[model samples]
Target: MSGIILLLQFIAAVIMLPLHILNFLGFWDAIIKKLFPLFYNKLCETYNKSMDEHKRGIFSNISDFSGPSKELRLLEVGCGTGANFKFYPSGCKVTCLDINPNFQKFLSKSQAKNDHLIYERFLLASVDNMTSVADGSMDVVVCTLLACSVPNIPAILKEIQRVLRPGGAFYFIEHVASTDESSWTGFFQKVLNPSWSLIFDRCSLRKTTWKDLENAKFSELNLRHITAPTSVKLIGPHIIGYAVK
Candidate 1:
């Protein structure tokens, strides 16, 4: 089994060598920026159906704010293509943030499609360092399908906590590593992780992101694991829930 795994990894590495070179040259980022949204949108169509109930339950809290005069402030870190815009409660003043400026055009189109929510602005910033956003300013913080790709999960979570107001919620949905290492999916994830990350913008299939969330010291944490509805078996394991600050 070990020998077979080594052979698979070697073959995958050789196959992905060109992509690694393109990534190192910074050309892959440009290509992914243009193409990823289209691919992600199709993925979300199926993914959203599977998580509709969970998303509705999580986003329901947005309507709990009292008074009609107060504006509901929301910040979505790594808000690629504004995929969660439809799930948001009406009248939300949403600030979208992403490290890639190329996503702005796609996000704008999504914002237009979901006209009920107020589009605040798009910030081209890394999730780990969001110094531009004021401390404790957001009523809610959201992230979906993003934690896998970030260089530092803990740093990003810290920033999410920092920018949220007292009693504010941080909602997240992230694919995680399979706990059962004996499983074939887990074996492939471990074997192909290096090549996969190289091809897909540093998205690690083996990150135990749920563990990081637990250690983040949120006042209240409500989390659950689920199998994401995707044909890709490597990213099937997922954690979906929210934590309150």
Candidate 2:
């Protein structure tokens, strides 16, 4: 009887391991989502000047402020907690998309706070397959710190291109692989990638995202690399720019 009880206990432990792991990942992700807004807001305070410099003319040709509907449309891909809402020009209808449903609550909070911006919709979908959004619909598509986690960067860029009207812009700020992969920083990023992905939901530290974006179907691409704050050495070097369709 004791042997049978022990056997059952071991079986239960085996069965619970994966479930526990999933739960932990969910819990960690939720905590990050909740705390990220505060962190990001502070980061912006410190880096706003640089960020604004990079984002110059990103909203050029987008017009109509003051609650006017259907004039200017902006779509944010992987808009975690809607952190970018404050940067948008007022009265533009904004659509947000994310794979993590957990961020919906945060996005709602952000939308409520930024009442000047009109909320079009929130779609719980990956950027690679945003079929729910009509083609050639958005005037601007924005992404920040997003491409690292996507499984197919090129596919997402293609989808962005497809959804953008001619002369529309896709603005992005992403951490990319080191310029020289043989550098010590690159070696560290490679070694730390597995653990980083496990903690941060598959965010790769060594993705050659800038090169991929350059190769995407864009009429013109302008990009520049900037050194991020030293605190984020794990994902520090960043590329910021826009690609025009």
Candidate 3:
């Protein structure tokens, strides 16, 4: 059993090494921003079903806010290429935002015509400072695998609180600190985060934590870690959770 585990670990590391290098160099962002549609289309194809389900599930508890209020407002911060999108019920509109404005074309071209589409035409905004979006302007905020890269997570949370209408919801599925507090996983995460952040350009598993959400003034919060088998050196730790405001 020990031998098998060691062998698996070796194989995983080999695979992730290259990806980590790319992340560190910030190559991924340069590539994605310049060629947005490719990123956009891939997400629509791959994540449509699972993401839709994820979104629907997140909204289950917060569905009460969906009634008419000048076109039901939904804000998806860190929206990337509209990837893995789900069809929210009509009357509930979704406004997507991301670091890269290049992704907007995907929504404009692919999103349902009825969508109230607010695609960052107004101004550039970051999670830390949501000057563009008004306070209490939204019914829901969805963030997917985002926040891990945010430089000022506290500010982002504050912004989320400010923009979200009273009783609104914030849903997310982020990679977080490992559930196993043991040394094996702990050491790897410490080693892996620096490398992963560089390769992915903005991701460091360390930054996405339960404490970040706990501090956000949310009345209700739910958190869970997700794990997947390693195809590479870095694997076996992720957290998926949702928070309700």
Sort the predicted structures by TM-score, highest score first: 1, 2, 3
Whole-model lDDT per candidate = 0.86, 0.76, 0.64
**Any runs in candidate 2 off by more than 4 Å, and if so which?**
1-70
Ranking by lDDT: 1, 2, 3
Candidate 1 regions exceeding 4 Å error are 1-3, 24-26, 65-70
TM-score of each: 0.92, 0.76, 0.71
Better of 2 and 3 by TM-score: 2
**lDDT of candidate 2 over 1-245, digit per residue (tens):** 44654565456545556644765677766665555556555555555555565555444434521113447789999987776777788787899998877667767888898999989898989999999999988888999888998889999999999998887888888888887676766766766565556446668898889889878889989788877655667667888778889
What would the per-residue lDDT of candidate 1 be over residues 1-245, giving only the tens digit for each residue? 87978899999988888887888897988888777777776777787888788788777776554124477899999888787899988889999999877677778888999999998888989989999999988988999999999878999999999998878889898999998989998999989988988767778999899999999989999899988767888999999888988
Cα error, candidate 3, residue 105 (Å): 3.0
Instruction: State the lDDT at 161 in candidate 2.
Output: 92
Q: For residues 1-120, write the lDDT of model 3, one tens digit per residue.
A: 446545655665566777656655877667745664564367446544544555465556545665355455778787765552444554456666776666666656656453534333
Please report, as a residue range, the 10-residue window in candidate 2 with the lowest summed lDDT: 61-70
